[model samples]
Each structure stands twice: as C-alpha cells, then as structure tokens.
Target: TSTGKESVNATLPVGLAMVRAIRAYFEETGYLIGFKPAGGISTAKASLDWLVLMKEELGRPWLEPELFRFGASSLLTDIERQLEHHLTGHYSANHRHAMA
Candidate 1:
C-alpha cells in the first residue's frame, strides 16, 4: 500500500461524521436509527471513543445494543476490560473474559 496504512484506519474521521448524521436523522425523524461502524474498529479505546461519541451525540439510549453495535470483537473486549477495571480497580487480561 502506498500509504502504508489500512483503508479502515483512513475511515476513522468518517465515523464521527456518520455519528453526526445519525444524530441529525434522529432529530429529523424522532425515531432512533441505530449506528454500527463496521470494519477497523478493533480496539477498546476506539470502541470507548465511539461509545462516548454516541452517548454525547445521541444520549444514553444509544449506548444500548438495540441502538448501537460494534463490528469488532476486540471492541467489546476493551469495553469489558474497562468495566472490569472500573469495578475492581485493575484491568484484566483480554483473554480473561469470554466474549458474548
């Protein structure tokens, strides 16, 4: 690849735009349209950022799976790590929790 980066990484900014669009659509329609940012979202920090962005843009309801979903296993893995860390004051290994 000329750019030396995967195409998915290039689309990160689009995620923000997509979330904004989701917010706009919800504002216009009064019915929530779910957001699923597929591909290249394979880390916990990125997942958390997406979640925070969603919660900020669309509020708490969007945090629900019925409204939001990540297309990567590692995304949920990181979120679980964060939750475990929150509850226990220490982060756990990625392999510790079974993926849902």
Candidate 2:
C-alpha cells in the first residue's frame, strides 16, 4: 500500500485492509512484521498513508523520515516542480539542479 494519490484512488480500502490483516497474522503467529510502502509518494496525503498504517496497525507513530523513506527519485522531482511553481508561478527546468 502506498500513500500516493494513485494508490489511494486505486485501492485505499484494500491497502488499509491488507495492513490490518498483516497485523492480525503477525500477532497470531508472533512474527515481526515489516511493511514498506515505497515509490510514487509525492503528496502529503501519500506520506500520511504510511503514518496511518503505522498507527493503525502497530499502535504507534514512527515519525522519523529515515524510517519512512519516499523511495522514488521522481517524487523529489515532483516536489521541486511544485515548489518552483508556487514561487515563480511557473515550472522551471533548472529546479532539478537545486535538488541536486
């Protein structure tokens, strides 16, 4: 499950249910569960998906960005584009260099 809008639009309920099921299975079998929702997460909502999963399933918040990494380089591109758009009222090709 991802926090990205695409994932949310495509199958949010399924993602949430899958997380729940994984949690239940882990609890029943005494297994340590690890879930990584990586890629296509450029929006704040997308980021929140991981937090929601952690809180709902694990009963805690892991707020550290190191633990919850946005896996796609393209996501950074999207963020840069949006920021540039906000600041300049247009997208700039040079914004990519700033990220680097």
Which candidate number has the best lDDT?
A: 1
Give RMSD to native, each candidate. 5.3, 5.4
Each candidate's TM vs. the true structure?
Answer: 0.65, 0.51
Tens digit of per-residue lDDT, candidate 2, span 45-85:
56566677667666653345533345544556666766788
lDDT of each: 0.74, 0.58
- Model 1: lDDT to the true structure: 0.74
Error of 1 at 59 (Å): 1.0
Show the colliding residue pairs in model 1. none
Q: Cα deviation in Å at residue 21, candidate 1?
A: 1.3
lDDT of 2 at 55: 74
Evaluated with TM-score, which candidate comes out highest? 1
> What TM-score, to 2 decimals, does candidate 1 have?
0.65
